[model samples]
Target: MSRGHRLALAILLLTAATAPVGTAPVTANAGDGALVTAVPNPTADGDAGEYAVVRVPTASTANWTLDDGERVVAVPTDRPAARVALTATPNATRRLTDVPVVAVPALALSNAGERLRLRRNGAAAAALTYRDAPEGDRLVRTDDGTAWRPLGYQPRDVHRYGPATVTGFVLPDSPSLPVETLRSARRRLLLAGYTLTSSRVVDALIAAHRRGVAVRVLVDAEPVGGRTARGAAALDRLAAAGVDVRALGGPRARFDYHHPKYAVVDDRALVLTENWKPAGVGGRSSRGWGVVVDSAPVAADLAALFRADAGWRDALPWRRFRRGKTFAPGASAEGSYPSRFEPTETTAAGVRVLTAPGNAESALVGVIDGADDRVDVIQPTVGRRDGPLLRATIRAAERGVRVRILVSGAWYVAEENAALVEWLNGLAERRDLPLTARVAEPAGRYEKIHAKGVVADGVVVVGSLNWNENAVSENREVALAVRSDALAAYFRETFVADWQGRGRVGRTTWVVVAGALAALVLAVVVARKTIRFA
Candidate 1:
């Protein structure tokens, strides 16, 4: 069957209106249990496809249930999943009226208006519901049919706390779903409808704020010496437009926000990228691709990290640096972090935040040395590098780190980098490095890999730009060093697909010779034209 048909089959399986296990009582996450995510309620039945599947954190080995009405289907057992499809019948109100959320010591999710409050016996619990819907479906346990919370009763300033969760998305150029697919991707996200933005994206938060969508953005505040005057102008525009724009510190500070291209919409969809320009660069453009998830725990944790980092609060419109207060972007809910690197400890998971005085390059080297199980790397510009990052990667591959790299760019910037790229390949071929491919082979400039990410042993380092020191040391950088398995696993799968693409760019052909001849003829014609003009 076609891929589209297969995808349809999967959804059909999720919504097949069948009851689950006929056994007696089965338990899930204990206590004032569970936090999750979901889409805004559909305005009517026309909003059917617009629903979001939600999966709360439970046993990795435990099966899940999505009880819309009499239809009970089993959601796959995983750390973060969105397999639960909520079928909203008309007048079937899905609110945060009932759902148990742990205290600040655990995780919580908030709506656009306020924190998600779980009401037990009409009393508000301290832990906010991690996933609460204003429109569509909210939390209702299949075990007891209890609605645990009331909607919009939680405070607006209930700071989000817990260890950082990350969603690592490397925009791959699927031949069928090319870069232009970004427009469709943006449309898909917009169609899902979020309370976080007015338009899906592209207008920045000014438009979102006006739409009553909570608008928050983090931009790199660092100077790129003389390289690209990109971030400054964009942030300026956003700030002037009445958006909540903040600048993370430049290369000089201790906790600067270096990578600034990623923004998570409504904590359900994320755009992780290096091409932060509202447009592309130097005659060449960019291709963007990513996944929209149903897991709110994953979304909430990531959004929390973006807020806690001090780099975002120092500059631009939300210039809180002068106020001397902590850089708390939103009120802390439950699972929140102090920065991208710090862990607030939510779901029994641990996190590590690798600082980048050296920027992404430093982070890359750290990963090479840190991996115990799997190592996956993604790059838009894995350009020429003589430094520690390159050496560390090679060493890790040699030592059995299961090193797999997806270089999105062609390493075509400098002749030197292309040569180095050749050397790295030669080494991998010679068994000097145990590397595999994840992205489609460099498909010229038309399609390139633009994600700079590394995930190892349930840890993820994702951010703006690529796998080159040019970005970390000289350019402005910002990223999250994630410590959640949910985020890390997502990075791993996306990395695998990208690596497969890289593997497909097989042996070079004589097309190079033909291309060279063509270039020579064109150059001659141009030269002759210039002479005639003179």
Candidate 2:
């Protein structure tokens, strides 16, 4: 009851109020399971929109603080979670990702990069050090959370399938092949392409839809030449028939172009190096290559890819997309060629599905790098000379492998292709390598070359992947690597025929050439007579 006893009791109560909460107070150590998972730099308006993501092992981050060498901001305690995205502008950060964002008024990430430390109780818990941050990209922890890498989007995937029987066909010679494949679909059909204007294909798709088959189509909203009236009409017809139609492209599109040409029909997957237009699938023009694989796994993988692309935020419904759109008048392929190559059913030992913005570039390069006997490539146009695919082909030739590249001779690319051929030949002569490059001469067999195909040893690559950097690095491209000697032989035969300009000109072409020659001769005779008389 004394004054000294009262003072001692008050001091004891004060010490108890400020003491640690438990027998073992939480300690801040570098080995603690906290980590700085992701950091976005140079977003929108410089560093104003930049953000950092930190992950803690326990649910609450109440005691954590983030330090950027110059500024230290307390982690918001309003929302307790294992992962929290701290940013100066919470609204702006939320637009970039769905991760929970916490506004830390003092949070500012340096664009030039620096060390970021996560501290608790004034001690270091974890730290992340980075160099110059790339613009429009985020430095995020890998899947294993061991390292950091710059990425603009989620990591792409490479799908692989086991052995299956594949039916191979070339364009202009077998236009009916792809249509027939579509018609054969009974359960479901997921088609993806850059353009779709082939009347025969549309008819088949409509028929499939009418038969109660689930038919879905996904195309690019803004293709290179823009969406055409014919394409829009076809899409309109499909949409009217209760078919699900979508277009992939917008301000937030994940890919530069939805340029994959493929279809999952029931349990089969059809992959092509052509569009769904007449020139590509109708075989009216273009020397393209396609295949129908009767495999459940392949079809499932393609269907999954279709769903991923078509389900993205950028994929708008056809009706919704065409609301304020004006379509351009587009030309259709009308030329006909002799059916020199027929669709042949063959079995492949394995099929590896490669996608772009992820694995196509590296996988194709690996295929070429593994070639031992011969490597043949046919493309409309190639990327830069130093691109990965071209460099791989050159490397193949350097290692005593016979390499042949046939590029398109279409007027639009004839000059550039010729220059490339000349340069390739010059390099071959200088290095004494077994490499040869040539510009394809259609020779009346078909129109310009449009196939993006490659035959390497016993493997054949067929799909929408162009041997260009953008097509392989930025686009949502798909390609299949079929390992089969028989399939290789079929594609090899077509490649050789096109390369040698040995395609059999149709009877109509012969008649035109003959008529032109006869008229020229008659004109010559008349000119001679007139000159003598004068």
Candidate 3:
């Protein structure tokens, strides 16, 4: 059977739903933020046990109750239902008896479908309903109660249109502002990105920290560093406010730059193509795509990733930015081009994640290899001619597939992409391939195309992975490869608008003409030199 056929069968089997796996707990990051992590019971000699950890951020004299749909699991009799602190408790595992409760019903939770709810002063604070959970694993909220994900302990098969839903964002077109959505971070917030000078986003993190929320930020150290860099200044400001801010790539750094643009708020993960800078997400700046995913597994995986990067280790040593470091001002957007298109969204399934300093290139290559028809790509720029991804695109075109690449036409991007366009056209002609490439016109409101995405044969891959070797091999990156024609079509629509600007010569056609003129000039120079020698 075809891949699609097999995927459909798998989803069908999941819908049948056997006796639900061990009760999957629902934990929300907002409201009275709750955490349900699986830890080894010290009393049980390292065997696993579920700990219902709750955080009441406010000072309250009211009681809170934990219910598993049927009966009251545990109720705290003391004032201030749970720990209300800015930091996580030292040890998360607690026995049922440890809870300061008035009474406890059957302590052992049901393994089948159960609606776990948390109520504060008789008001619903947060709740999670789960079914068919894997054994020995714990479910936690990546955002509010709306999204839940299992901690990513091992690789999982892609679920076809699984329970996960993907919400997309195109800058300046999103219904609500990105910063507005970010302000909802209630429990713990983790942010990782290359550049972050946006006052709105930075202020949000600072405010969340002051409000006693656990907030941590990790950013690239080099380009965004120095006493003059705006990003550095922002980091310093956040650090001063008691927010744990670390710079990736110290002297003994593993990656060139920590370039993943994402934020994990509660149980939700916001993956974006734009940075947290003004020119990135500002309504009338660069054109890009952002994806909001509420999957417990994905959120847990990203959270684990953030911890690993933020923690001090021998291999990837991180340096925390100290206060008083003079930081440069933010970038100026004096000559930004107008955006031609607006933001749009589409749902997708079978989403495969790719992380860098890992096997991101291989995963992307695998997707490209699967394309049988057309492939459309949009990126800020392509760095190397012989990069694995670039070569793969060329090879795909050699196989008679129509391949078109669109890169930004902004001043910073135009130079690099010019050489790339010329190189791709040359290869296509020499190999007689059906490959074409273009640089987006800076005519519209969209000054640049910062999005790094691909649409190929009923699949859509979008996120912060740039079209460069450093991004693939040396920098931290996150990408989502989705298997859905609806998503693919949405991207293809943007690619077409960018590829066809007002009265412009095709990249391949113009490159051919430019090549001919250059060749003629070189031939004349050679003839003159030969005559002089004679």
Candidate 4:
């Protein structure tokens, strides 16, 4: 028999076996066990695509009815103590969830606010009420069934790790740290990132795969500016070498972007604010911060995160995803810089792994709010002026904690960054607060600021969380909060160097300055000759 027919036969047998024999149906009053557990808003054509979940305390729900104030429909399940979905469209609803679905042709849920109740033989067993529903979101009851809230796309929880040794490094200074760490993997390696085009890293992964290391990679299916030919080629190379590579994204993707940068190598975890591109991990352009933690718990937590992200429905194998897809040609970063800071080994008293679309914003804001001495923020850019993070920083400054924000000086954001800095400085001067902001002057150190980092007191935050609402609320970003004075000092030193523009003049900076001066001299000579002729 076909699958559908088999399912029907199974349901019929279950119903016949579980149905109550010849007794009268029991009527339930208030405080009974049946409850409306969840309701999903209509995201498709009409109300038929929506569903309401009911949980019962007994095996059979033959006597239960769902009343939505406007109309009543009988609960259609003989399964006991199970969570079942009552929908007008069973086949479509089954595709969204694993719960048993029963088609109730008379069932219809409104998008606007409504009150629903579970009735047993005409008596109300439990009741649930909700306001207007959010598009594509589900309203679910609490475990105790006392409260209800909208369910978002949060899949991972905020994880914490106890004291352990961490090796911290800054990019363009210790580019070999990540590659060497990857090469040291013995049993397994799980790498996740927004993009991967670094040849050095790819070679290390291939070598690890060849030596029987179970190497797997997960990256964004569609990175900013789309996938590049070099990135696609790198992924193909890894797949050819028996490495498992998958990309995360699709119409039903849980995150706006899978943009975390980290790798799990056996019992060690490497987290960074950089992508897997030449400008980031290869240490050629962008200045970024990273850490390699030597703790089994940390590595295990990161490994779990990788599996959860990669095992989702949206994750597609590299070969399958590349079919009929086109890639754009992109240039690789070739800039080199002097090593101003070396990797440092330190011990954090505690470490917390923060991820986006759930706990990252509040956790990061807590970091700023807990600042007692100073808060130094380094980012490509921040969110709006009145955003939560900025507001928290301002509050910290008000409480006498010095706050300094350094933003990117890249041309694309230079104008707005300058404006924000001026506004912040103006507010500081007017209010007599210890708040300041500045645009980074790459000043020959590296290219522009690409680090999303903060050094507050003795704690340092390093990872790929951009200080914006969308990044914190929608994207799949990861960051680490390491409470170690040594690590904080290392990142603080680099932040100070970039903030003060104290690095030696890079060749490009010198050439630009020289060209401008030469142009000024020519203008002066022309003006003098014109005056003499007149």
Q: Which window of 10 residues has the lowest lDDT sum in candidate 2?
A: 9-18
lDDT values for all models: 0.40, 0.79, 0.62, 0.79
On the 0 to 100 scale, the lDDT of residue 202 in model 3 is 82
Tens-place lDDT digits, model 4, residues 1-534: 221222222210001111243222222432354444445464466744578887765555447788777899987446653678888898878766667888888887766666677776676665655555554556432222222222334345678889999999999888999999999999999999999999999999999999999999999998878999999999999999889999988655667788999999999999999999889999999989999999999999889888888886678999999999889899999999988898999889999999886678788899999999999999998878998889999999999999988898898887777778778877887799998787888878899889999999999999899987668866789999999998888889888888888422333234556899789779989888543321
What ranges in model 1 sit over 4 Å off?
1-204, 211-241, 244-258, 264-271, 276-348, 351-355, 358-364, 383-386, 409-417, 429-432, 436-446, 474-476, 483-490, 502-534
Higher lDDT: candidate 1 or 3? 3
TM for every model, in the order presented, reads: 0.42, 0.79, 0.61, 0.82
Which scores greater on TM-score, model 1 or model 3? Answer: 3
Query: How accurate locally is residue 427 in candidate 3, as Cα lDDT from 0 to 100?
Result: 75
- Leading candidate by TM-score: 4
* Model 2 Cα shift for residue 344 (angstroms): 1.5
Q: Against the true structure, what is every candidate's RMSD?
A: 21.1, 14.0, 15.3, 10.5
Residues 257-281 of candidate 2 have per-residue lDDT tens digits of 8899999999999999999988888
Error of 1 at 209 (Å): 1.9
Clash pairs, model 2 backbone? none
324-391 per-residue lDDT for model 3 (tens digits): 44555655453445444454445556666678745677788878888999988888888777788988
Q: Ten residues in a row with the worst lDDT in model 1?
A: 189-198
lDDT of 1 by residue, 338-448 (tens): 111111112314333222323345555665688776777666546545567666777778778777655544445434434445556656777756764333463332345
